[model samples]
Target chain A: MNLVLRAACVYMALLFVFRVAGKRSLVTVTTFDFLLLLIISECTQQALLGQDYSVTGAIILVGTLVSLELGLSWLKCRSTRFERWLDGTPLVIIEDGRILRERLAWLSVDEEDILEAAHVQHGLLRLDQIRYAIVERNGAIAIIPWREGG
Target chain B: MVEIKRAGDLETSEDLAFERTSRRVRRVARSLLYVFVLLAALGLFGDGPLSHARAGHESGFFVRYERFARVDGTTRFQIHPHPGSSAAPRRLFVSTSLFERGHVEQFVPEPASVEIAADRSIITFPRVESGGFVVLVMRPLRPGALRFSLGEEGGPTLDLALFVYP
Candidate 1:
């Protein structure tokens, strides 16, 4: 009982914290972000296990966390409102070579980030060469280049 | 309402209203987080100014303990026994509930002997003068309200309560 409750609480807390942190923070992982992830998992491990060192305790914790994740996913699939709230809808930040400065500021994204994604994904050099740039729900930028005929 | 239109021949779906509302909600959430951190720092969570507490009586019996403690986190409980005019060793009676719920890690000025009774544990201390104290380093095993009592045998008993956080 304690094991399941601990796992559930930890899962809910992590979900709220990461949601508040915004998706862009995790989109690009820096060296410090990787270290931070390691530290968080270390702290979570102690809380989940408490003093129970037996293999059964570890198995129970793992099962509890996995079950919680499956339940949340199922709930998300059933309700579009929940899916939208849990995973934010994609926003178009750039259209027809014009940038939406306000949306970029709100998302903590900049022109350089869009251009970098463009460069890596499409090898495009200038903003004029792109028709649209969208910030996807997973925080990755999707770029559409102008038609060759145009 | 959402608007679906073509951007350079590729269809796009955008909900400007939802985006605006979500941005506002995130702003509020960040502001609340700052307040939460401030409260935790003020000892509302534990181990801060509000957590330190003391209880005792005028009979020279006193105890220092934490009003709020964390499960599995070590905390100190100091007991001061009144050294009367007579120079005889003192015996302390502690409720068994304390031992049952708290794991004693160490004891200062170790008791000469511990005799367990049905409801309480009697700890005998060596003869001492005034200003002598016994310290119990304990880690609470469970979370929630922990109630216990301690005092010298045939003397005043001080009841202590601690709220343990998980």
Candidate 2:
């Protein structure tokens, strides 16, 4: 197989995958999303550069994977219940300067990570200064400072 | 004092209008003056030949070849690499006597090495790699206005000459 033709096929496959993966995949890199990214790159490499690779075989496999992703994204976008099932909602890990240990454990986030993110993003150095903290859907920590007036 | 407390006259609407217009004109004049100063500075010091030379040097080496006036003697050529690019180490290749009309010559680097004399009168390069610019340095085997087609891959090519230096 010619190098240029193989390269073009791999490029098209990647484009199709990205389009089907939905906006959330780009916005956030969850553990699952990261795994998908690695797998996709590996698969494309096999198709483009590997000796035993067949362009038609690679295209078929990539097309099927993309179709599945598109179907899931469509379902998740249309139904709130389905979206919740596929993409879990954010959980509040802290409220009114009190840590919610249960929610933190559920999200697999440690207190140190939350504190560091808080200090970095909002300049909230002390735990007592944080009024609210939430683990956003993208796995990022958001911290709200306690109101001075309050 | 009561008799002296007379009425004070305020400026008319026309006067207020004139004052506003004068203020606007003054603002516009100031802005235009700033623009004129900027353009004058640019014209005096910006986009001149010196700046262009500096820019070309900063971007990459400049290579020029003059026509060969006399034949059968070695001519000196010098190439100074672009400012930040001197560290990469480059090569110079040459195919002489290529000006014979309708005669095509294939000259590949023998063993491919890149090292030139301190005076830059010699040409050499290392083993071929995937990328990098090649500067073709021609020393005519025989001189009498020789023209050669020369360029490196991914770089500009031109037909030029090296005249015999008196």
Window of ten residues with lowest summed lDDT in model 2 chain B: B1-10
Tell me, by DockQ, which candidate is best.
1
Task: Report the C-alpha displacement of residue B56, candidate 2, in angstroms.
Answer: 82
Task: Assess each prediction's global lDDT (C-alpha) against the native.
Answer: 0.84, 0.48
Location of the lowest summed lDDT over 10 successive residues in candidate 2 chain A = A16-25
Q: Which residue pairs overlap in candidate 1's backbone?
A: none
Give candidate 2's error at residue A122 in angstroms: 1.1
Mind giving the per-residue lDDT tens digits that candidate 2 earns over B1-166?
0011111221111122332343454456557666755854553222322222211232454443233322222232233333334444344433444534212222233424533333222244443343333333333334234454443333444444433421
TM-score of each model, in listed order: 0.90, 0.33
Q: What lDDT is reached at residue A57 by model 1?
A: 92
* TM-score value, chain A, candidate 2: 0.62
The interface root-mean-square deviations, each candidate in sequence, come to 3.4, 34.0
Off by over 4 Å in 2: A1-52, B1-166
Q: What is the Cα-based lDDT of residue A94 in candidate 1?
A: 87
